[model samples]
Target: MHIKPIKTEADHRAALARIDELWEAEPNTPEGDELEVLVTLVDAYEETHFPIDVPDPIEAIRFRMEQQGLEDKDLVAFLGQRSRVTEVMNRKRGLSITMIRKLHEGLKIPLECLVKEYQLVK
Candidate 1:
């Protein structure tokens, strides 16, 4: 098993192919070790070259709502009222600390995502 730093897209592709071939390798063996190293290297390269930015706070909330089949009314428990939910979702108002905490706990949205700064609709 041979491996090198994945620099170019071609190198990335080659690493992926190798990983596929070694995917069935049993653990505690040379092939398994090579597969683990290749997977880690591929992940690192992708993160550096194609970093994904965190979702906007409002968008994150909307995404979670969709995932959980929730509506604006459901958000009242986490937010306050229907109007407040609309305002927050529309970016007409910002999330307060209390709202953030509730959303994090109720919706299982990460605090890091909730605290991210986003431009209110202007």
Candidate 2:
């Protein structure tokens, strides 16, 4: 086991290659242990160097709406009235805490996506 911290892009690439090689490693074995450790190190390195931003709250909502074949009218139960839903979908309004909770509960949109700070259209 020659594991090292993935500090550079080259190191990241090598770790990924190693992960591919170990993709079929059997569990409870030395090879699998190495694979797990390498994957953790690579994940930590990528999280620092190649951080991914959370999706915009409205966009997340829109994506879920699309996935579930829902129209704006369907969001009224979570977002309030039709006008409020339109305001939210148009980016003219920000989600209130209550709306965020309702959306998470009713639509199963991730709270992380719903709670992210997003710019409202002026």
Best by TM-score: 1
lDDT of 1 by residue, 1-122 (tens): 77899999999999999999999999989999999999999999999999999998998998998999998999999899899989999999999999999999989999989999999986
Residues 51-89, model 2: lDDT tens digits: 998798998998998999999999999989999999999
Q: Which pairs of residues clash in candidate 1, taking residues 3 or more apart in a chain or in different chains?
A: none
Candidate 2 structure lDDT: 0.92
What's the number of clashes in each of the models? Answer: 0, 0
CA lDDT of 96 in candidate 1? 99
- Taken over the whole model, the C-alpha lDDT of each candidate is 0.94, 0.92
Per-model TM-score on C-alpha atoms: 0.93, 0.89
Question: Which 10 successive residues of model 2 have the least lDDT summed?
Answer: 45-54
